[model samples]
Target: MTSAHPTASRQRASAPHAKEHHMRKTVRTSIAAAAAAALLALTACGSSTDSSAPAADGPYTAPAKDITATISVSNWGDPGDKAVYDGVAKRFKEKYPNVTVNNNFTPITTWTEYVNKLVTQAAAGQAPDVINIATEGVELGMSNELFTPLDGFLKNDPEAASLRKDIDPKLLEGFSKDGSTYLMPNTFNTMVIYYNTKMFKAAGIERPSDDWTWDDFLAIAKKLTTGSGANKVYGFAMPYYSFGITPWLYSNGTSMMSADLQTAQLTDPKVKETLGWVRDLVTEHGVSPQPKGADPYQLFPAGKAAMTGAGHFVTGGFAKAGFSDYDILPWPKGTTKSTVFGAGAFAISKTSENPALSWEFIKMLTDQQTQKQWADAGAAVPSTKTAASTPEFLASPKHADEFYNSLSYAKPVAAPRAYNVLDPAFMRAMDEIMSGQDIGSSLEKAEKDVEEALQQ
Candidate 1:
């Protein structure tokens, strides 16, 4: 969700070269115009009915299992995601034998592209009944009136209520707008330092603690780096994407926007310092590769770099490459131990013909048993603490718990209603800074760009 690139390991497998960024500038002008028109039309129609408003009169009763219905769901799919979905569907069939869920999965791509495609599809009357929305697209989806509120179901259904209690409230908060819930939080990810144990051992550097600081991390990176040119092994492969770099800014006690999501904070002194610090890792310290086109997910496991910033999803790639000598650590502290996190959700489309059936399916997706299966797959941290703490999840890479533990100090990735505009503006500034432009000037431009876009 923090990434425009699919966060699921399954989606990543099909698009290994895809940039792991948030929203990028991939929306076609025609489709973007349609999206704007759709939002404006919905707003003009006073479409914010009680279904999407705060009022929940009573429980939403799901239809009988014997009732037959076929509903299509949209998602980013690859072989792995297909397998998981098939498995879940099989189990879901045992209970609702007559209900059918047709998954419409698109290949992994930039979030802007996906959103534009959805806008085009909806215009053609081919939108799916349900959508697997990540944080990056949540606000856009909401602003476009793409989802129906689930407060009635969540507050009234016994099973859904149980799920609400089991999931972390913070994650629930991410999927909520105003006082209505539009989606159920499923799997999530948070940033952490993934280091190669063998490389650390070779450098004679002990593993950093959960409380390690920025200076300590820099020192270790310097020690681990060696050689030069083509044969050089960078100590770290700095991720240049929004999801990858946000943790650094977050750790430094700054972010791209204000908490209210109404203003840009990119020009904050702390933000400038953080960007400069990351730039120096490549330009001055020479411990990390240039962030412009870095691929830490591949570089870290290929043994080309000793460390990288990533989430649990990278573990799948590492396992496929037969690289297992790595462990995770909390992001090093700056003024605090803060880090960025993101979650995906199962959102029922406002245009769905069978809202009750969609609610039942969403409940199935959020079940603890389903979450445990997802945790065992090792892609993301399950939103439910019970599922995330499973032995199966903790079996690999010592300190796997750090992924879940970081939630204590982590903030949801910055995804405001204007994300489509905000993400690209911020990313452009980051790219300029990484390419050696002046940080202060770049951020000033980014701030101006973002604020102006928001006002429009």
Candidate 2:
């Protein structure tokens, strides 16, 4: 069932802010862990000159009504997400009375294992009609091999085509292989500072505003980490491999590769500075933790640490814990004002007998009205311009205002499946540097190691 276009597909949401550079960044990774990331980046960068036309060359339209079909979809557990999908499924059933849907859901706590389960189901020809997938999910599944291209349906259905607002170009890049669409975007998260107000007051640091920078962040982290026996708090979190460097890298205007995602070009001075800075956060500054598990939930929510790096997913957990008074501040400005956003999307398996029906259900989950409803309810950030701008999302919720403002300066790296590999490798290199090795030499070796892995 492979598409006529032998080339892989890619989806990206281009924003004005993605064009900006990253600020200070410092990270540590061992060579073994970052290899896959390097390969994924290289694969994504490969052949910017379209290998072929999009897979949507065929003109296919879904049936009008009364089809005896069903779609079983899976996603991370979010009441808001389920509700939106339920609404869409209901609408779909109304529109096509004959369609029956069998929905299979797994809690987010177990989402990391969903791909393995899916692969087994798929290999046994028992894959669902649709699936909710993120970066790890897609690459692990090599979703392009499994999911049918929606460009054909998108070209024919106005309802589907009207989704331009819902789908950001850079996000499309995240799901893309070359330059065509593979997965349909549902929602996205922009990385910003989520600060605890109580902690801020205790630390005697002023509330963060748009004017804050990395230096300001360090000051606040220092203050918040203060205390004596039985009450000592760590300042900032240690640099984690995932989602930690996005704002820093983008703000510093550096990338793991050249513009094309080809050839290891990460040895730039800015990248070195960023990595050194990250290491220093742990060693010299005594601000953040060592780049290990990098779990904010374990640190900040429990009040063992001051500031930590995380996304919208952290908000619900924080509120549930009764850690009142927090805000989403613009990621403290780096060398550049650019920001990094993480996201997820939905796609239908190509092997399914109900491609058209599956798309109808998937699109329904990500529509404008539904996205806003969910985001407002505190599930995930809406990807659309209109939905995100709403007052509910713009106000309160611990740096919510500043978090929203940072979107104007945001961009996301094309998170390909290889990140699952590259992230660990990148983190390992940092491990070596932290162990007291030469910074430039380690980076140069990492550059070689990362590029070599990509060549594989």
Candidate 3:
């Protein structure tokens, strides 16, 4: 998986006072499980305070003369992200010569901390005019009233409509709430299996087809398992985080949360079955590493693991290491073939001093030219299909198209307003189950924890 997972910094920053203050009232009525309660509270709260104020709605008409105003944009900083932002900002400046694009991006190690920081800043009225939000924070941002609905702007701008047509509708749906649009879908990541071609040939196993089933996957893994310890080439590197593990849940037609995002599905028989199946890959089959401290990002590229699941973000690291012998494939099917994804969007904060300027800035950022820059960087699949299809985005890796193609059947990762709170619960259950705990009881306990959190 990508380093998108919470890191040591997240572990140290657990339970900030500010987070408690912001989410205090976010916990709604008990919903039998923490995941359900989190989703319920998040869905019911709407927007917070003055953050839900709508942006000025109309077709954005750029001023004939350049306007001298600054648009403050906030995003979780990543190394490659700043260059893209700077490039887009430079182009926007060509249109508004005097406008200053102040990007207030800070490095963030976890989505939980990023959301907390945004919520705290909004409370103090220091919120940026434009903010980058991901699927995990969409409900939280909405519940906190952090964004203005974008429907009015899109309705009035024909160009915006054209842009929307070029994006995957699933991404737009992921960024919307209550039948209204709140964000301009930007980029996204979908899970896929990365396999080492050299290992497959050495193991004398034929490359598996995209339609291979779970049984086929197990057989392949068994054949690929050949060594032990640091020299061990495990057949697969089991994913240790929620997003990394979700494709399995999805393929089996169950998830940690229900379709409506109002109930916990952790207790479902299918969910339990999926967890057990993965656990057995480590314990019973010994084809995958014990996931506790295994880092597939390192192990896969270093050739310690034969295959691992990750998204487009992995390509950058692989390139840096000059590891070019691998390729991607869709996750092996279980009951069905499916995948999970998470998307990011650029949203105008409701409290922006310059809503019109912010809207114009967003348009520039989502333009094909700007999206192409991001696509070339290879951090994510570009939101625009045009940019995504370009050779720069596809690069030279085999089966790279699988990343974008998965969008056809991908569901957004199950994130709600209380995701920060709920993720720990799910992870704890997974940690125990992967460590050889009974799957059924672990899920039952997770459901109980969910119920308890809601009651609080």
Reference-based TM-score, model 1: 0.86
- Arranged by TM-score with the best first, the candidates are 1, 3, 2
What is the number of backbone collisions in each predicted candidate, taken in the order shown? Answer: 1, 59, 6
- Scored by lDDT, model 3 comes in at 0.69
Of 2 and 3, the candidate ahead on TM-score is 3
**Whole-model lDDT, candidate 2?**
0.56
- Candidate 2: how large is its RMSD? 8.8
- Residue-level lDDT tens digits of model 1 in 1-456: 333222322223202433432222132111222333343333333323333322476655668879988877766534555676777777778878988878766544443455555655665665566677676656666766677888888777878767788787878887788887888877888888989999899878888878999999999988888888878898899865677788899999998889867778888999999999988998899999876665676677778899888778677656766778999999999988998877767887776777777777777777887788778775677888889888888888899888778888888777665666666677788788878999999989888877887787
Clashes of 1: 1
Worst 10 residues of 1 by lDDT: 22-31
Clashing pairs in 3: 33-450, 33-451, 34-450, 47-145, 48-144, 48-145
Between candidates 2 and 3, the one scoring higher on lDDT is 3
> Each model's C-alpha lDDT?
0.71, 0.56, 0.69
In angstroms, how far off is 211's CA in candidate 3?
1.6
lDDT of 3 at 429: 94
Which is the better candidate, 1 or 2, if ranked by lDDT? 1
Q: State how far residue 132 of model 1 sits from its true place (Å).
A: 1.6
The lDDT, on a scale of 0 to 1, for candidate 1 is: 0.71
